[model samples]
Target: MGAATAATYFRILTEGPHVHRNLSTPQLVEAALARGEASLAANGALVAYTGSRTGRSPRDKFIVEDEETRTRVDWGKVNQPFPPEKFEALLERVVRHMAERDLYVMDLFAGADPTYRLPVTLVAEYAWHALFVKQLFIRPEMSELASHAAEFTIIAAPEFEAVPERDGTLSSTFILSDFTRKIILIGGTKYAGEMKKSIFGVMNYLLPERDVFPMHCSANIGPEGDTALFFGLSGTGKTTLSADPLRMLIGDDEHGWGPKGVFNFEGGCYAKCVDLSEEKEPQIFHAIRFGSVLENVVINARTGEPDYSDIRHTENTRAAYPIEFIENAVIPGIGGHPKNVLFLAADAFGVLPPIARLTPEQAMYHFLSGYTAKLAGTEAGLGSEPVPEFSTCFASPFLPLAPRVYAEMLGERLRQHGADCWLVNTGWTGGAFGAGRRMSLKHTRAMVHAAIDGRLAQAEFVTEPAFGLSIPTSCPDVPAELLNPRNAWPDKHAYDAQARLLAKKFEANFAKFDALESIRAAGPRVSR
Candidate 1:
């Protein structure tokens, strides 16, 4: 199917008598309540449940393999190929199923910068899903809405299940993206994150062709106009760290580095709410308000208070709200080229240093490696233990193109802009997860601030023998002992053994990447 076929299908899907177009937040909330789709919490945030699947179903996602994407998309376990004919048939079924229901339509923008902005139309089976996307994506003004035409259309019918045998899907859930048709079809899952991430995958493919480097990271501007980026997977504190009181938040996740600067790909934030508290994360805690949407968060029936601690439904509890909910948020969500870029890893093994400066080659090496622990409850199928994996470019799940495409773009930009890069472990310290405690948010924040403000640049540095990272000897507000991971461990030999193990893992992982000798040599030096 081509763009013309997609346009015709979109017209058929929207022509239903029960279609609701561009509903306001209040209207959406009311509709959700009336349809028994959601209930309002005491704080007025809509509480919704995603049945069966509570997190993203990455295994079921597929991209149509056609002439347009056959040669471009990096087909692999991550970017799985779906037969174009299968997609066309499945899309027809989804459109027909959705046309019969009361659909909620939302037209939104993906990028904050108009130059690179992507107009998106979301056709949702649930009113709450529409509200979720409305808050999550850029809501155009009435003036812009009058002339808004979607470059891409997402048809989401969570209730419609795909027959795996007939549809050629792995399961009942399916997230199929067709570049030729410019349509994303999602069904058999109510996980709203699928909708958010599918578009990110699309942007990851589309932006590189336009000379924009798409990133799975958070961005914020310091008081002096210096911009910093936080690249990490979920539970690594990208949203929490970027929501700093002193800095102006550009965006919490998903951004693009273009010729002008960095621009947010999202209008709002989808922050993890597991164990969320006002004391620990005041900005995110308070941001959940009237217009916000809370997913799978347990609420008190009598008092209607949300228990952020409760995770009976899932550990991936989330809060989605407009960026304006955060104080001192940049309206257009655009910032200058980042002066500092930090790669965060929740090292469950407690082997990596808390903070370390990186050479340009080391930065590229780590960027390609994209090492991070996969914490439980963050995804659909995960146990309590943190699973260590290297998500290429910190966004392998979302990147449709080859890893080198993003890695090369980042290298060129870093060289052109002269941005300093650092590695900050936000995971465990002293010993592995079973033995040690998580790194203090206070200490991590102090170190991050120091790096962002150039305080760490002035500090003396020493090489870490195992990984070859430059460990800062001293940092303001941080204890000197905590600056080095080895010193924090009770057993020196045990720490060395753990560090050596991690170094071996790094060496093994980096061997898979086809990079320059300099970049490869920049990796951890596993000692004999």
Candidate 2:
């Protein structure tokens, strides 16, 4: 077998078939090794394999592979069709497998440093697959047969430390005393049980002593003390929009809040890659070529490496790489008082104002409504789920604590800093998918343009009934041609039909929140 063939086998076994579940792991490994020598021969200087070792330290790593293991799960496909429960299931399985192997997982991803890795949650089998195969933990000798038969097992768990758990590690067992011992960073949407070798990569070495909370928001440390924070549920373009080539992106996704404002938990961005294109997403497309980590993506039919469109294996298309991958990814994902805090809601109903200048109450109302999508069935006959639906703050799960914890934190941060907030509806303004094209990424970009350009900061604000928020009727940097949904509506009648339908939706959805304090007059302070 040649390099391509070897790569193909490895891709299929680890990323291809089993990732989608077509072949067994052992079979894939054997075939990949069989093709390894040929791959090395064709590539000339290419080493047959490479790997790292696991040490007794809080952050210890060792890898050695020679024609043995040198493949990774596609980096771009990490979070496709992100089912909150499914990811959690995967992590739980990894814990089970760790117990089976007696190999304890430890991590120490914390601090205000930008080089550090963000936290993630991976399922068990996937985690096992990532480590042993992708990271080349298990190696082969001159003889492939013996290498194939290496026994694998699990034995025990260390006693939980009676001492205070600062970052979650046994201080005594740690070979590296100076290090904080923990399994992995738990920031972002990573649930506990999934396979998360990606987490291991960043955590292998981290700057010591800082609390980085797992959050899902874009961050940028502005030139001044001003920091701009952008929040959106997945697929709403948090990473893509927050990342401006001209402006420095502090961090694309997760951040850690501490005494001196908030710092980024990740050194980079973990972006979605399905239907990715340089034309539409030049930054993300270009990032994948260098330091970017592509997950679960199909490769070019000829390259046998990544196929951005091959979401068949999993809809969780993703790319994880440092913000540096973008020429402007800020080194330390930290920022100060936000100049603008944008709450992203991909409104599927298309009834909400295109870009609303929000009052604190409406901000909380939309945040609680958490509206932005209807997930259509990838299957042939499965009925479509409502695209525009409400989720608590649009983040249905993944806060180890509670929604209010984050809300309070957000409010406190904004208040002390004296920042302004906005609600940008990136979803359908004219109609939902089938009825009309979903909101244009262009329009969303324009809204963001007006935002950073300071136009939205001074636009005339109008009060909306259902949300009781303010919508900016005019703003600079934002094209006058695209202020309203009508600008994008091709058919006025169809647009109106969808508009009425969405209006009904708002009425219906708000009814639920009517009694809730966040949106209720009596609930929590909707706005200060």
Candidate 3:
């Protein structure tokens, strides 16, 4: 859509002459607060609440089942099929509802690499939502905006609710994407994640055809120009680990690895803010200042201070800020081919070692498996107690293609780049959640630093019996006792039983993949 055409589309719905276009941060913050959509916190951050729905509703997300996406997309539980007529009807309702209302529109790009970047047009009902995409997406310079054109457009009207029977929707909350029209529709939910993730899903669909691997991971580069990638599901420390002080952060979440190199898919970082502290995470701590957006975070009304520890709203509390907010962030957020790739899993079972090396075949196997502990409050249905589940590619919900498509891309990238891969468990140890404790951040950081610095390569390694992974006996500044999962446990028998049980789970999950025998053999060996 061209700029003039986009303005005309908004004009059809807008009753007044009030259409805000690419407002500055200060202007957006002031407009949000003045309109009673947001409040200023003690730290000078804008705190906005996404009522009822604090996380992305994957169940409510659907892709229009048309000739364009019917056969191309992996249709299943995550990528639910929506009738073409249903989407068209919903779009009409949304348009009528939004009509006669002042709208906030922001035109931006999704990728940092200009070669592969996507020009996006975001039309939102709320000022905070406008400010959100403004922070999350790459802002175009005045010169760039003059000749700007949008490849995809997103229209978010959270106030409008759908009737399932009348609208042919599952619920009042609906997020539908019609790629053929290059448009996305979201309604009945104020959660801004839906807006951001919908574009990510689009990239996941379109980029693969261009031989670009869109990853749900974080990337960073060292002072020596060594780049590393961390792949994991939410609450698995992909953001925390990637925001290293010594290394320049490329991005906290979502990236694309292609023939050129690795480039961040986002211009902002959406970090989990529950229990956030300045002492522990100073980088993220400092990032939350003027113009940053805090979602579902409880704030002290009197003092205007944010209670990061409060879960009254939801444990999925988050802080969204521009990439430049991080003091050590790399500008243009691009990095060379990664020298190391770390697959992070929060192992609630406490069976997997804190760190283990992966062979090339094993890397592909685990990449497809995408094992991780489902943390509480990370999703709509999950409980406090961690549940072990396999999320294919660490992002099954967002992926539009088959799992094998991404697995093959990852395998090819690793081999072509000669990157070393490792599985790092950032969850419990000694026993399951109740019996064991979460891995210390300091210790995990130490081990990660060692791995990135090539110090772990010189350390003595022992083969772990349960999964057949090589674990280092010693890591600088980390306790030797914590290196082995068996040694950390007081009861060796309990550890062995738990390890074998986890191995069985891995085997069962891997069986579903129609891969070569060698790739399957790379999986865990569980003795019956």
Best by lDDT: 1
How do the residues 53-110 of candidate 1 rate in per-residue lDDT, one tens digit apiece? 9999889999999899999999999999999899999988998898788999999999
lDDT of 2 by residue, 1-528 (tens): 245643443333233222422123333334334534212111111111111111112122111111221221111211112222322333243334333322212121322443433322121232222222222121112353222311111111122111214323233121111111222212111111122232322322221133323445788654554577777877777877877665678777655555566676544466777888888888877776422334455555464445567666556566655455577766555666467778787766555566776656556666656666655774345466455556555544333234554555555555666667777877665556656556677777777777766777777765644435566777654555345655556676665666666655555666643334544441212111
Model 3 clashing residue pairs (backbone): 42-304
Better of 1 and 2 by TM-score: 1
lDDT (Cα) of model 3: 0.89
TM-score per candidate, in order? 0.97, 0.61, 0.96
| Runs with alpha carbons beyond 4 Å of true place in candidate 1 | 2-7, 375-386
lDDT of the candidates, in the order given: 0.92, 0.47, 0.89
Which regions of candidate 3 deviate over 4 angstroms?
A: 1-16, 375-385
Rank order by TM-score, top first? 1, 3, 2
Residues forming the 10-long window of minimal summed lDDT in candidate 1: 373-382
